[model samples]
Target: MDMEKEMFDIIHTSEFSIFSLSQLPHDDNSLLLGYEGKVKSFDGRTGKIIDLWEMHEQRVNTIDVHPGNSNLVATCSADGFVRIWDLRCLGKEQPKSIKEVAHNRAVQSAYFSPTGNGLVSTSTEDTIRIWGGPHFENLSIVKHNNKAAGRLSSFSAIWGWNDSYIFIGNIQRAIDVISTENNITTPLKSEYMTNVPCRFATHPYKEGLLACAGGGKLFLWTKM
Candidate 1:
């Protein structure tokens, strides 16, 4: 019998600290990293930077790659804006589109829809916004009161497999299943958990299977 071996690999080092990171959806060897008011793409295998830019005026909070188009990246920052970047552009260029004041307070997270035609952003102001197009037209807004700040401010949200719905965590220790078409929120039952669920991820290959975590515990839920 052979045993599995573990190895540690350092991809890149820099003077600045990294706050957020996301890999290109189609490329495992590439990554998008967020640091103090800046974002960059690095080749993980070679430890060489592919592109770099000062993206925001404050520390970037989150980065998400477009599911259908890896070249499109979405980033939110403490400056309260959500900017979409085209990775094909040169390092010195500006974002392809910027959602100015996407949230009234510091933006916590921003993600591209699975279809890559829309974007979703959450903020410390207890609001989640949906946007469409490169110009970032406001499509919808869902409000909830989960006001933790700083490192704890960020709550997870992701589109459903078919893009018909979104799953968001709330302060009340449950997940909110929101309908994209009607903007209705239904709380998922979580009576067994003692703490608020701060993050959620749907099963990649199985429908109705979800994994959520917070307060040092993980919970798995499936459709009944």
Candidate 2:
């Protein structure tokens, strides 16, 4: 189907394309959105754009509010940097801290780990880089593939389970569960999905309930 048809399908299914989305800490009623380089906070149910900020030099690739700190927001961009911003501050204020080389290449995705201790990011460089905190500093970069060419296309997506294990998805239509318990490299089980996921989100209050946007359909996975 084409774009119009897709829109119709989404409307019928009670969903829409999200350019970039983040849930406010402790307040599900508010959402932070990044669309076309503009950031806005809105009432989730009413669709009201409560606050707006436009400071990114390029299109925003990701937007995440600090899990325990509602005042802070983190964003990554095509410009090759990750930034921590204090949303409580006013307009025209730049990010509190900007990591100029947060990623070697365009950051494809970024997210705060569920436990609120740090951030997990992925880039087109085909590597997953973990930052110790929202500052995007004190980082450790994990190369997903040992081979050079393989690493180039070996992109990744990440989600956390109690900060103990992070579920990573990739273009290969496979998921890798990484354990943060020992900071060791061990490959766990992989789930073969029907298609590369277009979007993914974990349930805030449920165990093993994964909301996956893939294969032109939505899936809810439950743990056995």
Each model's Cα RMSD: 3.0, 6.4
> TM-score of the candidate numbered 1?
0.88
lDDT of each: 0.79, 0.63
Residue 75, candidate 1: alpha-carbon lDDT: 87
Q: Which predicted model would earn the best TM-score?
A: 1
Clashing residue pairs, backbone N/CA/C < 3 A, model 1: none
For 36-94, candidate 1 gives per-residue lDDT tens digits of: 89888899788898778888989998999878777777888989888876777735765
**Model 2 TM-score, 2 decimals:** 0.71
Across 57-171, the per-residue lDDT of candidate 2 in tens digits comes to: 6667789877788787778776667777777664654434433455667776777777678777777676777766545466776666412233232344566567666665544
* Candidate 2 structure lDDT: 0.63
Candidate maximizing lDDT: 1
